[model samples]
Target: MSATAAISVRGLEKSYKGSRQARSPVLKGVDFEVARGSIFALLGSNGAGKTTAVRILSTLLKPDAGTALVEGASVVEEAQRVREAISLTGQFAAVDEILTGRENLVLVAKLRHLPSPGDIADGLLERFDLVEAGGRKVATYSGGMRRRLDIAMSLIGSPSVIFLDEPTTGLDPEARLEVWKVVKELTEQGTTVLLTTQYLEEAEQLADRIAILHGGTIIANGTLAELKALLPPAKVEYVEKQPSLEEIFLSLTGSTKQGDHS
Candidate 1:
């Protein structure tokens, strides 16, 4: 375990027992580290074990083999400490539609046994730009507002690390941008974020460091500039051939799906 890393993993492996004891392996010796206060993205398509990795780091699931540490605490050995040091927002907004947005924040604060839950809720509501909607039921809020509330709830205990598993999965373009802004603001406030996403642009726009997860293992890991350097210089012919954003993304992730390169 590295003392300075906010999150670290080494030779991690996991397998699930499916249908009559049939084994399905997800992660195979996966390893990566997230720096404190930085946005580290695990970029992979669906079924690439992004969620599985987040689960293990957040102490919600155990790894069958290998070691992972969160905030310098062993996720396996210090599960309770890890749990206390982190917050997780799943693919969907986990807000209670029946409750008012302010109520949801206050509920989480109370569950955490914090003093002055109402004050905490009010501060969060203002910080997340939800003060106007705080009194309304969450069901009436827009997708972006609900997502903002979901993230604000995660900040209740001021955890050292946050695991966002595809935080913008079903959001529209405008909503996605809103979430992106929030993510950036979290890092600015010294909160380390481990974001898992299949959206190439999401990683490109937000992550200070990007790790390409393919087949449950990291195939490429570096700063954006370093990863971009993996490609050769663009060819200049009679007419220069420029690759599309999709082409660059697929190529970087070690994918073999490029239709009609010609």
Candidate 2:
């Protein structure tokens, strides 16, 4: 493991027991490293073990094989230390609809046994741009707002690393962009992030480096330019760029990111 790497994985493997006696393999000797304060994307389709890798690294699930280190602590051997150094925000928004946004943030801070939970909640609410909505029930938040609050909640303990599993899934283009901006801001604050997504544009727009998981192993790993270099350079050709359907729709309907736009 590199000294500057916030996460390091080598020869990772995992499998699950299926019906009767059959075993289904997911990860097969996977390996990668994420530098501290950088965004590393894990790209793969459904059932490609992207989430499985995150689960193991976050110490939510034990790996069947291989070594995973989070902030220099072994995930399996020093699970508690790993947990203390990391936070996870899964695909779905795990907010309590029954509580207001402020209440939700305070809840997580308290759960982490942090000092001045109320102050912590206030800071996060302001940081996430949820000040006005902070007093409102989470049930009323838009997909973007809910997702933002979920991420803010994850920062309650000030974890050094954050695992965002398919963070922008199911969001509208505008909402997705909103989350993208937030992700960019996270890295700017020196937080290491491991993002998993099936969205190609998401990875292209955010990751400092990308690794593609296919058939239970890493098939590609490199920067955007490096990965693009793998393919033959395009022959020179001139073509006019046209606005995409998303641009046209957003231009025509002028749908706001608030309310039911999600």
* lDDT against the true structure, each candidate: 0.89, 0.87
lDDT of candidate 2 at residue 198, scale 0 to 100:
75
* TM-score of candidate 2 on Cα atoms, chains taken together: 0.90
- Write the residue-wise lDDT of candidate 2 on 11-75 in tens digits: 99999999876889999999999999999999776787999999999988999999999999999
Query: Any idea what lDDT model 2 has?
Result: 0.87
TM-score of each: 0.93, 0.90
Task: Return the top candidate by lDDT.
Answer: 1
Q: How many residue pairs clash in each candidate?
A: 0, 0
Lowest lDDT sum, 10 consecutive residues, model 2, at 253-262
How far residue 105's Cα lies from its native spot in candidate 1, in Å, is: 0.6
Candidate 2 global Cα RMSD:
7.3
